[model samples]
Target chain A: MKPHWLVRPGSIRLLWIVFLCILALTVLAGLLVHPHAAFGIDGSFGFYTWFGFASCIALIIVAKLLALLLKRKDTYYDGD
Target chain B: MTAISLIPPGLPLVLGALLLPLCTARLRALLVLGLPLLVLALVWQLPAGAVLSIDFLGHELAPLSDSKLARLFATVFAIMAFAGGLFGLNHMRVAELSAAMISAGSAIGIAFAGDLVTLLVFWEALALASTLLVWSTRTPQSRDAGLRYLVLHLFGGVLLLAGIIGQVAATGSVAFTAMALDSPAQWLILAGFLINAGAPPLSAWLPDAYPEASPGGMVALSAFTTKAAVFVLLTGFPGADILIAFGLYMVFYGIVYALLENDMRRILAYSIINQVGFMIVGIGIGTEMALNGAAAHAFTHIIYKALLLMSAGSVLYMTGKRKCTDLGGLFQSMPLTAICGIIGALAISSFPLTSGFISKSMISQSAADQHLTFVWFMLVAASAGVFLHAGIKFPWFVFFQKDSGLRPPDPPLNMRLGMILFAFLCIALGAWPAPLYNLLPYPVDYAPYTYAHVISMLQLLLFSGLAFFIMLPYLKRTLTITLDWDWFYRRLLPRAACPLVRALDAWQRRCSIDTLRHISHFLGALFLYHGPQGVLARTWATGSMVLWVVILLGIYLLAYYF
Candidate 1:
């Protein structure tokens, strides 16, 4: 049986392209819609776009660092 | 406050729990579907203000209060029970279903409780019933996890009880009113509520036990306990200030641990703590807006969180697999489940048009309104991170990632129906917030959908999604778990006990054996000297006794002369 079109390699690349377009469109939206921030710096251009991206990157990095000490086999407690 | 006789909304569910096991499957299904709707109707029928008052301990205690906050909480709990009953109608054991009703019923009881003592009693009942729900799974893992859950809750209960005693002694009243953090009793009360809220140093219990429950059992487990804690905190000690710190920690802690989690269910479990943290923070803020946000968030959260769990539960129900490593590409077989799961995910992420969008923003909007710049920043980051972790990661791993060569269809009819009901609710509340807004404890003045608010939220969440794809390599789950606070008790305490137990065993043996030997040796010498056959005991002892008496008489005379 043929694989589902959603999962096939060619469609996968197209999905990525679509996702990127949406990402760009959100940033471009900053021109028409300015996010009113209570804080002074938060209202600057594309603040949420960059902040959201940076926040996730930071979360992943910090989580990875902590994983060094905290990570154990999923069966970590089964021994007890 | 009127004194008209009204049966409490939750009482029938508790009674129904007993009746369920005695009936046929068809009858049981009817009661499960009918009882919670009955409770929901009864809940709304309650008029605002103190409705049922009683004399207790030389004070007027309102055992039933239909305050707006109480009614709001009671309404959600009833919905949770109804949906959960539907979800579990087929898959869950009779014991689990019965226990779930008891748990849900008591949660309703707490919501309507008017005095501190009444709330505490209902809380304890909630704890015991919840423990029974976990134990009903009858797995070794769930049994031990249930024991840990019970111990922690009992510990929390003790703190609450002591707090109530001290409070009563200090104030001479039991009204469950808002308290300032001016007394040790208030602090104890806060600790008790926070512990159940999955606060720090004791937070590990939620993720440790909840995921261990059977699939449907977990859906029921997710709705109460912590949400009830939020209900109490909203009413009992709003604006405590310190909760802000605890809440922030939980939000980040949940995100990071979930990032590292492999088991699909534990990720959801950790996210429960993460989600409740937002409500706690709002309670700390304690503006009318903030409190409304917290209460509203709790209301919406129960629906979406349960929806997420229902979809996840469906996957587990069909596949009999829970680990991320063991699941993937199930969207092929379970399209409806996947779509419903995505809807739940979107709602939980607080995307532009969902129940979460309207409710969660109120908390952040309150923070921003107060110019709590730091809190506002953290909440924004956490909101984005919520999208990163739960909104994307849960569905991404369970349904859409690399194919694992397993094909399982969607769950049974009841489970599908359950998911659809909550899914509809998520969109309905988001699209039309007036019904939920109207039920808020405070008058609703805030509008959630502004062009600016919607735009910022979209950028934040969409970028978070982009980051997820970019960080895919790092976010790939390993076959591992992150260590948490429960390690102190579940692992460390038990491990630490081995040597102490051994030492105590040795000490007990010495007390019974070696110490007894020493006492027996002394007794043996005394017996040897005093025996009837010994020299002093013989007939000659009479002569010796007389000689000693004469000597004593002589010594006494000499002393007198001196």
Candidate 2:
């Protein structure tokens, strides 16, 4: 039997394959569930889905940027 | 006359608090506990519709009643006071304990208030007492937080007073009744109530101030203010449409910020906003089932939130640390607290056998029945988020993360006992919801334990758990403040005001120095010019007068000739 690749440093290339697998799984699940019946493309359903996903990504990006700017040493509150 | 005492039930707690400073620390603590117990006994003995009336400042006030809604809130408040007193016994500062008692009693007064005047009075009293609790910490940060808290609450009080005056002017009645949203007066009252509920734009105040309080102080602070506001909204503005949107926003705001928060106590504080969001949504739906859900949720939430805060308070007490980064593997030493905290976490997440599931499900059911499929879906997603942020993230990060190797002993016996009592209540209520439902303003017809419902909830929450572990890299803790609506005051206003204040100070200093220099120079010149032997000062008063008169006479003669 072949060993699972994630256990070894030599298998770093497997990480991308894992990522793609998850993405494909998500898309397949979406198609199978047929969320279009509940959320049509033309209506607010699409907007909310896109907006929610976009905002989540944007928030993560903004959080990272703010962390760079405003991050403090853990002992900052201790002095006061 | 078979007459019930007309004095307000909450008055003795206030009076006792005033006298508490005179007592020894031991006696003061006893009185703090005893006063609320006595009030609870009084509340129980009073018959339904028992009325109390008094006139103060030309306003008639009545704060006695024993209606189901009043009984429900009052009962829990008394319980909270007792539990809070037990928890606070070791840290017995007379001022804080007394203030907490007064805060609890005032909430009780609002619960039993028969008129708007009485309710408004007690509402303001709640503000004063709770602010005193914050200020009693005697730290600069706590003082600042307390001041900001006072400003927000006082503004809310003014809105309430204005609304009451308008209602009195319009209807010529001071009696408290369910208000329709059509009138401006009623809408004002709703705004006032919503403000205290920690509704949006201003909702940041709860998380901002509460986490800044002393460890014991947060336990007391958790129980009263927001729940009292929920009680008022339930009574006053039952079916407002705007509340639905506000609730949804608060729910998301709580999750987003809680997800970003690093401080353990602050995370719990944000979770309070999230849980209250459910109640507010229930209140907005305003069906029998929804109101019942709200009332029951309030009962359950108070216990679980207090339990959560108590656990966090214990951790703070033991380690003197509050941030998630500073705490981990604490459960190894404090196993009991960890277990109790996890109980609270599960209950809050509405796991099938916990209080939240039985109570919060009704609200969502009502939304679905109302054909609010989108709202229901959003709430379902939020439920998943709740598990991600609070239900699991809290305990996992604080108790089971990469071990920080800091183990403090279990908290004091009284604190443990308090946590146990509340934990027991959480489980008991979840197992047997009938008692809670019977106390609701409406009948409970909806069932919470359905096979499909349980399965879906588990799938959603469990998957969210999977997401949390998977996304742990993104969820790493950092030492930075997440700016909220509070940035309007904490950062923006202060930053904006500093320059203006500096300019004003500079201008004032310059003006003062310039004015002093000019005055001194003028005084010196006057001394030089008018002294003997100086330029205009000689012994010539009489000569000058004669010259002036002669000049005037010559001018008059010339004018007459012309």
Q: Pick the candidate with the highest TM-score.
A: 1
Candidate 1, residues B1-562, lDDT tens digits: the string is 2333356777889899988889999999998889999998888766656467778778776667788988899999999999999999998888788889988898998888889888888899899988988887788999999999999999999999999989999999898989998999999999999999999989988988898888899999999999999999999989889988989999999999889999898899989999999999999998999999999999999999999999999999899899999999999999999999999999999997899999999999999999999999999999999999999999999998899988988888999999999999999999999999999999989999988888889999999999999999988878898888888887889789989999999889878769989788887787787778665566775788899999999999999988
Error of 2 at B45 (Å): 2.1
Which consecutive 10 residues in model 1 chain B have the weakest lDDT in total? B1-10
Q: How well is candidate 2 docked (DockQ)?
A: 0.09
Candidate 1: deviation at residue B208, Å?
0.6
List pairs with backbone clashes in candidate 2: none
**TM-score of every model?**
0.95, 0.84
Residues A1-80, model 1: lDDT tens digits? 99999899999999999999988887787778755669987899889998999999999999999999989887878888
Error of 2 at B170 (Å): 3.1
Best by DockQ: 1
| I-RMSD for candidate 2 | 6.6
For model 1, the stretches where C-alpha displacement exceeds 4 angstroms are B1-5, B506-522, B532-562
Cα lDDT for residue B479, model 2? 75
Give per-residue CA lDDT, model 2, range B1-562, as digits (tens): 3354555668788888889889987787688778878888877777667877777667676767557888889888888888888888887477888888888889989998888988988999999988988888788888888899999999889998899889988988888878888888888888889888889888877987888777778888888999999898888878777888888888777777787789999999998998888889988888888888888888889889899889999999899899998898788789889989999999998988889889888888788777677777677667777887788889988987767878699999988988999999889998888888887887778777755555445555555665666677888987756766776777678779999999999889878869788788888889798767776777768888899899999999999988
